[model samples]
Target: MTAGETVRGLLELTRPINVIAASVLTFIGAFVAGGVTTEPFAVAAAVAATGVAVGAGNAINDYFDREIDRINQPERAIPRGAVSPRGALGFSLVLFAGAVVLALTLPVAAIAIAAINLIALVAYTEFFKGLPGLGNALVAYLVGSTFLFGAAAVGNMGPAVMLFVLAAIATLTREIIKDVEDITGDREEGLNTLPIAIGERRALQLAAGLLVVAVIASPVPYVLEYFGSVYLVVVVPADAIMLYAAIESFEDPTAGQSHLKYGMFLASLAFIVGRLAVTVPNAL
Candidate 1:
């Protein structure tokens, strides 16, 4: 490959979009904990660590899933031969080292969370991906832990607890739907995902049910006074979108998962708006 192609392939291996999204989530977590202003340095470190860790996780996942991608996703960097497995692995290790260095600058609790997440990221594809719901749960936890990690960085984890639970449940629902979407390839690869273990329809139904619970509890932050009333205004629409996405998965798992991601992003925006609505006014 040319140098430009090699650089592009490396970037593709990191899945930059996911890294950015995860970093945003970590920042939101710190913001919700009311620390973005008071503890700017810690928040920055947490967000950077989260982004680097997510990039590492994605690269390593791509490396391990190289074989499966040949069948399920031939366009992937490794399967298409744009990047070699060794290169991807090495790139992921460098990102992991960056994450560790950034994480070490945080508080002890954040450091501990970072340690667990790094280990989980490394072990996920090889050890957890084949197990029915375990893989999905692990991914969910890792996603949600960003909130907790950020909160811990600022020494205020209480507010982030609810955000963590909400993000985790929503992520778990999406992961289940994605498993259904990937059932064919997973089955071919002898990996028993949730959809393969249970019927696809059943798995989708379970995913919908989980999303229902998250949607119902979506207003808890507002109710607990952690957010402003504007939270309800935004979250209600976000909840509706998520519910529709869950139902849509029954007919089109691909579209369902994609729409679900959009709704989740919207919900995250609500968190920012709600926090700002409260904090900005109080500061004035």
Candidate 2:
């Protein structure tokens, strides 16, 4: 591959969009904890650590999933020969090192969270992926932990706790839907995902049920006075969309999962807007 191609492949291996999204989530955590202004440096370190850790996790996942990708995702970097497995592994290690260095600069609580997340990320593919709901839960916790990590960086984790719970439930729902979407490949590879362990319809039903709980609890931030009225305005529609996606997954798992992601992103925006409205009274 040309140098440019190699660089692009490396970037692709990191799943830059996911890294950015995760970083944003971490920042939102800090923002919600009312520390974005007072603890700017700590927030930056936490966000950077989250992004690097997510990139490292993705790259490592790709490296371990190279063989599966050849069948399930032939267009992926390693499957398509855009990047070698060894290169991906090495790159992931470097990213992990960077994440560790950044995390070490944060508070003790944040450091503890980061250590757990880093270990979980590394162990996920090999040790957890083949399990049923265990793998999905692990992934959900990792995603949700960003909020806790960010809040911890600023020494205030109470406000971010709700966000973490909401995000984790939503992520768990999506992961199960994604497993349904990938059931064929998972079965072929002899990996027992949620959909493989339970029937696809049952798995999707469980996903929808879990999302129902999340939607019911979604308004708690506003009720707890953590956010403002604008949060309700945005979160209501986001919740509606997520509910629709869960229903849609029964028919088209791919489309359902994609829509769920969009809805979740919208929900996250609600948190941001709500937090902003509270912090800046006249902004909304």
For model 1, give the 10-residue run with minimal summed lDDT: 275-284
Q: Highest TM-score among the candidates is held by which one?
A: 2
Model 1 spans with C-alpha error above 4 angstroms: 282-284
lDDT of 2: 0.95
Q: What is the lDDT of residue 237 in candidate 2?
A: 95
Give candidate 2 misplaced runs (Cα > 4 Å).
none
lDDT of 2 by residue, 1-284 (tens): 88787889999998998999999999999999999999999999999999999999999999998888888889999988889999999999999999999999999999999999999999999999989999999999999988999999999999999999999999999999999988878888899998888899899999999999999999999999999999999999999999999999999989999999999999999999999889998999
Measured with C-alpha atoms, the lDDT of residue 195 in candidate 2 is 87
Candidate 1 lDDT tens digits, 1-284: 78888899999998888899999999999999989999999999999999999999999999999988998889989998899999999999999999999999999999999999999999999999999999999999999999999899999999999999999999999999999888888988999999999899999999999999999899899989898888888999999999999999999999999999999999999999898878876641
